[model samples]
Target: MKRILCTTALTVGALIAALGLPAGAAQADSTPRIDLRVLVVSDGGPSTDAIAAELDTAGTPYTEIDLTAADRPVIDAELLADTVDGRPRAKYQAVVLPSDNPFAANSTEMAALVAYEQTYGIPQVDAYTYARPEAGLQYPDYSGSLDGVRAEVTDAGRAGPFGYLDGSVPFEDNSPSVGESYAYLAQPAAGADFTAYVDAAVPGTSQRGSLVGEYRHDGRRELVVTFVYNQYQQQFRLLARGIVEWMTGGVHLGASRNYFAVHVDDVFAADDRWNSELNCTPGDVDCPDGAGTPDPIRMVPDDVDHAVDWQEDHDFTLDMAYNGAGSVDHREDHNGVDHLTDKLVADRSRFRWINHTYTHAFLGCEQDTTVVPWRCATETDGSVRWVGRTAVVDEIATNRAWGESVGLPLENDELVTGEHSGLKVLPQQPDDNPNLAPALTDTGIAWLASDNSRDPRQRQVGPATTVPRYPMNVFYNAGRAAEQVDEYNWIYTSRAQGGSGICEDYPETSTCLAEPLDTATGYAEYIVPLETATALGHVLSNDPKPHFIHQSNLAEDRIAYPVLNGVLDGYDALFAANTPVVNLRMKAIGTELQRRAAWQGALRDGRVTAYRVGGTVTVEAPDGVAVTATMPTGTTLAGTAFGEAYAGERSGWTPSHGAPLTLALPSSAAQATGTAEPASATDPAPATRVPEGTREYTAAH
Candidate 1:
């Protein structure tokens, strides 16, 4: 009979109680029992953090066991007999050893753990490595120094572990401070499964070495990896995440291919009348007295055509949000409508059209209570009130109607408010704006774009799902040119004072003729961080979406064009190097966003719990909360989460894996409910407040 040495004082009764299972829930002794335990054996190093980070990113629940704890003694024969869950073999599906030479300093502990591992047959991952004869882990070649080598993935490597790669991935030398490095250069042992190899020759020799290798020991899979966890390279992070997935026998839930969508807001027909305005202020240095007017040679429909052609040439799609003020006329150049709309209609396949709102209304206000009633009429009532239920409905309908009238279909059904004016409700709560729910539902717009980090609660408002953009688009508010310039300068140059490098020429006075807008500066200040965020899976929104640009960017001699070009150039450069980045239109991304939001809501609402049993993973939602997950091929899915009929059943052949499958209980109809308590006049605006109305707005309508 096996004895249980209970750490954390958890008994079968305790676990059953904690899991809310009935007293008789445990199956008969002869039944195969599945467990969700992953043993993390670490000395509290970066490798440990790296493992934890990937687990967190995947939303996988895990319990960490620290090896370097001062109070805990080293492993001995007695402890090994009762190690972890106290089964003769530890009751864990997998084990993560932070270092390659896990038994380096402590031979006794190492031998004890090694015996337990061989008996248990649990798969293991060794994240760090070094030559250790005592541990029987050796690098025979013994380069004796870390190599600045490029890491290339092998064919088996792609299929065995990482869900991220279909082809090879390279970790290139990015910076002097933290060059691409492999800690140990070792030859693969005989019959070992070598997964990855370093391309660089070991010091003064025409011989490269294995960077990652795997093999079986005692009927268990063992993976050896080499990559500095703290180097903070995007590729390193990606690999680390993939390794965790491999260890846990799980795959990422959604998005088979890596892609990004670009959302261009305030896309009106070419506005030749309004040129790119030059910032001429009262500041002592750069301004010519009262010389603010700019030449009217602004972007036209032809410019938009050229830009679209450029994107098409590069095989990319764009999402354009239009405010329906422009009309199309067929009579000569005197057509009452904007030609851009006509051009967009002609080039429908290249773009996805979005409704921006009729006439770019302000949807929020400052310090106004009951100012924008939901049933207001007229711009004064709407703007003064700063967003009411009626105004929001009207804004969305009017703009959508305009798009249809201009022969451009509003197929996306996504609304980005003109000016991103938040909907200041008749009754505002500090945490939620339940009032906007009805307006959103009435407009039939399921996806809404916001600015200034809106929707901190990450909850849906009625029928509307709000998506927020961050880091502020350069042309979001054209009037704030000086502020935008200053911010960019600080971001680009490492200078203590915020000045663009152009000021180097103006030695006596720190002034330039105009704000700096160049590709090189823009790439460093804006595009690189954006790309980094995308690669890390946290761009403007919580997940990777397109970097937002504006229609105004297409204007000749405008800041938008150069910045947009820089973004595309960076994207192209990365793509050329074989990094997977799909350039998609917003319509596709918005649909995906809706699915992601719904899935996120299910998790946050505490309605679902996911865990694994044996080789089968189970998703439990006792409250009939819909449960949906995207699991890889080969795994079987069943139970109430799949369907009541399939409860306690197995999926017949693995259900085809695709986008994240959403399991959701039916939602109740949205009500025109007031907040539990309205926000006090003195209180700061609620985070979900739309980006309109405030003077510091950072979104284009």
Candidate 2:
């Protein structure tokens, strides 16, 4: 019996040795504290820049080392990690390199990075790299332009990082002549531990090659991407989230969502129609004087009904920026009753309403239209004469009062001035009217809309904060498709092409049209796709800025619907049900921007500290600041489920309120480690075990 007992003890000791654990160890060890920051090594390339942009947009903190900089910091083991209070601590949760190997082969810097990643059990991302044996891939079977290719997310990918997608990722082919995308298609190297995440069929072949995959070798893991792309490309935007999640293990210091909102300006008002015959509007500034009668475009009762139905069908709401003075003028002209106003008022609850002032008055410096192209009016002393405060107050108050009288739901804090006036206008009024700020404060306005084309940054105007809005190219003066196409051609075509030469003079901002567009099909074919692409870019960029169009586009032929529909449909095709378009009201959008600004400032100032140890995450921030994070579904805050679930993860902003925010993660949560086990030979890799030494230290400490 003594010999048998000794044999049992000896067997147990051998088992522990095989598992790489100390004697009497019962389980794998816990990971050391890993800081929630990314390290980016850039070569000034577009692919690296694109990833950095994604990190910035999500409010994720990162330290970038430029390869071209003369005084760039060196990569070393000491820089990557150190001991904190007798415990090993990793300084970065992930590393992003310009390529798989940016340094010389077998260089100390490269060896240091590999050792750091292996020691911390952290992942590395190769932003863009070629298909070669060094990257654990066979030479390219097919290489060159990837434009118009339709790639697929593998089943393994669907179960892993790329699951947010519903399989298909179509590359854009904007112009036939330009090679917009390029990639190399290759298979995994023989006997390599590689798992393809995103792939496409090699040209003229039945076998598929990996475009994105994971390569595990020499106790380190890397996310290898074999394509060239920039920040603006649709394909890159679609895959950026997955890439970030894979690098950071879906536990990071920031969150992202797709947002879109539309504001229809000049509601209940008339817009001057473009004159195709005279090549400009018959207004005071640029047309032949008295060339034709002024014909304005206004929405009819039928148009109001169609708008409500369209909103219901699309599950979206439009913010109608109305000028109550237009209804007052119509009432006086039609014996004090107007059908369009009555229809809109009866269905007022169907849409959001913003105070657009009493009339569409230019609230900037008084205009001097005596000379062509207009200028600011001057005082007797040659000083700039400004519009007074009373005029601005009346415009805001009268519109609010009018809306209330009609039982229209309104928020007094939101305001969009006529033509975004009372603010600066280039070349004519270079400064805001001195009266605008005081008027806004008196009227209790908190959020004011500014044209992104002119003022793209949010700024203070007394008690009010500016909310920059995108101006849709759907012209305010256009009421019909043919009229819209005619004006677009007039603005974009060259003077030699019998149109304005503005595109030639300002090539940076405007691209001259190849030729005149056909008025019959141009609005539907050319203009709609171009505008839709631009708007979609904003939505995918985590931007919350609202887009503004004129009520005239919803009148007459209702030309704006096609572009709006294109944007909606295109988004649906690209994203899965887990990710929905976040449509926010003006106030809500303003608040989101405000929070982002504060959070980004906090990150920039190094006031935020976040990390994960074992099954718990901790975040610290200054008082009144909010913390944003994306974590696993089972993560909890203060004993309750945390964040709204989207794209297979939970993410939201939690107010710190001058306290530490601690999250309790479930037992199944992925834990960081000092060293991880090799991936298995399977389609989906298994979670690696934490090294035993760290766990023993954690147990002791």
Candidate 3:
């Protein structure tokens, strides 16, 4: 029999007495059980979808009932709770509704949901509800645009669910001409049991009103949110964690952490410079003849020193994707000595290094660059001619051998092909080079880097699993701020705006710039912030994909710093020290993605089970499968403390060795407060008409 562990001992008689039960009525096995799952009832709205997205990112299992669907399951007591082997079982630990009430006031579904929450002490989230008496708030005293508003997390919020944040939640206002945020901010209703978690000062008034708060009435609790938002908004992303933690009482069947890592490609190589006259790099396909020999941008020894110092100052490490042949070529040209390579090798231990192949060769099909846009070379038989497997293997092996010779720290199993070649290139090389996978297998590579923009999903190339990387917009050939901005304008601006009109041609994926940017000031003022925001979004979304830039960005003007610093600084301002960014290596990130896939499959297949009964949480899964969980700080597993603390809770991944994994919750867990006060006998007033301008806000979502 599987044993259940509890931090404190309690006899059946004591439990019965505590419950005021008859002497023979209660048994040791009759403890109420709460399943570790969430129930989301969506009304095809962005707010509810945002919450659902958060749950998915955190790896939490939830059942979503689409109200718009004709065949949706009815919300009834039988579906919410049942008896399991003589134990009372609550099917879901928490509930999320589209609003305070999406159903008719006296509907049976609403009645059943209320009764279920009351009986199980489960919390409910009123996702994007109006701030009316029905939701424990007065009709909005101030309701309108809240763009650029800097809201505060009250003391109650800090002591409760929003402790991870550093007191402020600033709404994003990306454009001045457009309204990005709208909310109905209001005070609590008279005699209502309500407490605000987040609030902002009303414009033109000294009074503060709630945007997010808890409402309690009629023996039920609801976390009422008054603002409109979607999944991608920064304000929503910051508050998502607190919302879930509050609803789940800080215990859930999944985990999340903000992750960020950057890979600097072509570390030892020189990138051909962009030509302002030709509007392209001379060495690239688009340049005309007589565009002139390429003036390559290579980092000097001082640049290497600056990189090491910058890494130390920022408290971050960069993965240098080096090309060994670049250094060899430089030595042959410069009296058999390359000072930049010598300096980097001397300080090589300061940064992580990855194999970028020997000469950054294109491992894909043979290229026919005779045309304006290149295509794969074909034989007379019309079959694609490929770069042989031997060439690919030599490139990888030669790089590894050179790194070993120089004592550079390296992981032999990790490889990044030049330009993420060898894989499919649309309209050019439709399929992967047949020789590439075999070459990877020969090199014993287990993790290969691929471009996330081209192929976002991780797929197998021989024995290697591709690690998708985000390509930063910072151009590979740009070594100066002016050059970077010039290229950006050309790709994004319309032909009417003196650009190549690419953005106009592909309207969906690329938005045309209204006008050309001033190249001198654009890199610092616009590009840095835009790129930083994009990268930060990935970090906040629990994505572990590493962002990549060419080494040129780190040399010359060092334009990448402003963007990197902006991301770190923005994160620092939002999160407290308890929740720092998780920087991981490429291999570790790939492993994380693999584990998540397996764990999610187990959940979807119903092969894993988890539940909380009193102070004991039980988890069971197939042998060798790791289970991720977030629990109270002092919770323990196998008689030892469970996981590392983050955002006021302990969470991590642990393997289930074919036995039931039991967690003993701390005694303090029993004293944790609910999201709202205990239920009262009074009913709230019926909701009134929403404040003026509310319809416009609702429609925006």
Against the true structure, whose lDDT is highest?
3
Ranking by TM-score: 3, 2, 1
> Poorest 10 consecutive residues of model 3 by lDDT?
692-701
- Relative to the unseen true structure, what is the C-alpha lDDT of residue 479 in candidate 1, on a scale of 0 to 100? 25
Write one digit per residue (lDDT tens) for candidate 3, span 506-541: 898999888888998999888998999999999998
Off by over 4 Å in 3: 1-30, 288-290, 671-701
TM-score (C-alpha, index-matched) for candidate 2:
0.91
Number of colliding residue pairs in model 3: 0
Better of 2 and 3 by lDDT: 3
Candidate 3 residue 171 Cα shift, in angstroms, is 0.7
Q: In model 1, which range of ten residues has the least summed lDDT? A: 666-675
Q: Is candidate 1 or candidate 3 better by lDDT?
A: 3
Q: Which digits, one per residue and each the tens of the lDDT, describe model 1 over residues 1-57?
A: 000111133444543443334456443221112223455667777866666555443
Tell me the TM-score of model 1: 0.64
